[model samples]
Target: MRWIWIDRILEFKPKQSARAVKCLSLAEDFFADHFPGWPVMPGALMLEGLAQTGGILVGEANDFKEKVILAKIPKAVFHREVLAGDEIVYDVELLHLRKEGATVAGKVLVGAALAVEAEIFFAHLDQSRSQQFFGDHNFVFTGELQRILGLVREAGKRPEQS
Candidate 1:
């Protein structure tokens, strides 16, 4: 199954920034093992949410021609624990964007309080290079990714509002 951590795209600005949210539910599988008595969202999963948000922003900035992959996480910090029923708002700002890769500064907030912050770097892989290694069907939801991020308005429609 595809692991889509973020639930919805609240807002997006091409080549600049994006805001998205994820609501953790009691049925989340990880909660069973993360902590038996006191369930909490894993820090790693929080970072993954941030990366997924930033990765989508980077990919959209390039029209999804290049496969954006997290290469390095230069910095990450968690200020508090995230629990089930918590809705996390991820705000990511692009620091730089180039042919090779991109960098972003991100923050995760629970309501008005900051929960986590990170600096992420991602490498852009050429489509041909990726296809050679992973084959054509590897990314079954490339279009879906765009749709989830609000990059694509509808089927056969041009990406809306940049």
Candidate 2:
């Protein structure tokens, strides 16, 4: 499944921070199986959402030269459950970045309340290696992600400089 965590980019600061949103709906596939009677978004998927947002920020910061993959998730905490009809606003800040890896701190907010917070880590790898790691796992960027990237670029007011 092509899981797109971010629905839109509300704000973006190049090499610094970004804010994006994800609207949860009952129509989403995961909700169908997560729980029958009472559905709650999975914590792992929440982490995935944060990772996706943070990875994009890192990739954009580096001009997407190397494919940024989630190498490890050193720390993650779920403060609350995200339910259908909730809009999760994710804020991510670049904590550190180097040639081989990067770290980001992210928080997911449901309205004004914090739902989840995590410190995510990513490793930069050659495209070929990344492809191999994914191993036929089809990951396609949804239109939402493209739109967010557009907004991020616009907000930054600069083309991605490698």
Candidate 3:
């Protein structure tokens, strides 16, 4: 099953940055097991959510042509626990981009407070090698994720409220 952490894309700027949010719901399965009564969103999952947000940004940077995978996390620190009913935002910026890979620095924000900070690095799979195994189709940015980018673009068209 495809695990999509973020609920929707809030803002997307191709090759530059992206912002997305995930609202923790008490109904999420993990909560039931994480703690019998006091549920908390796992920090690793939070990082995964951040990676998904940054991954989309990196994929869009190359027009979704490269197979982008989280190669390494050089840094990540959790400042606060995320609980059900809280909304967290993933704000990521493209720090470096190249043919081989790219790096992104992001912050997980719960309102005005910083919940988590991380630096994610993505590596592009060798086209010739990957095609033999994964085929010509781009698997990194699937239909669901493309829809997210589309959603933000559409939202951008609406007249702003003064």
lDDT of 2 by residue, 1-162 (tens): 666767778787778988888888888898999887667988888888888788878987876665677888888888889898888888999999988889999999998999988999888765445656665433433345556688766767766698
lDDT of 3 by residue, 5-117 (tens): 88889988889998999999899999999988988999999999999999999988888888888999999999999899999999999999999889999999999999999
The better-scoring model by TM-score among 2 and 3 is 3
**Model 1: number of backbone collisions:** 0
Worst 10 residues of 3 by lDDT: 126-135
User: Which parts of model 1 have CA positions greater than 4 angstroms off?
Assistant: 127-141, 151-162
Worst ten-residue run, lDDT, model 2? 136-145
My TM-score estimates for the predictions, one after another, are 0.85, 0.81, 0.91
Which of 1 and 3 is ahead in lDDT?
Answer: 3
Which residue pairs clash in candidate 1? none
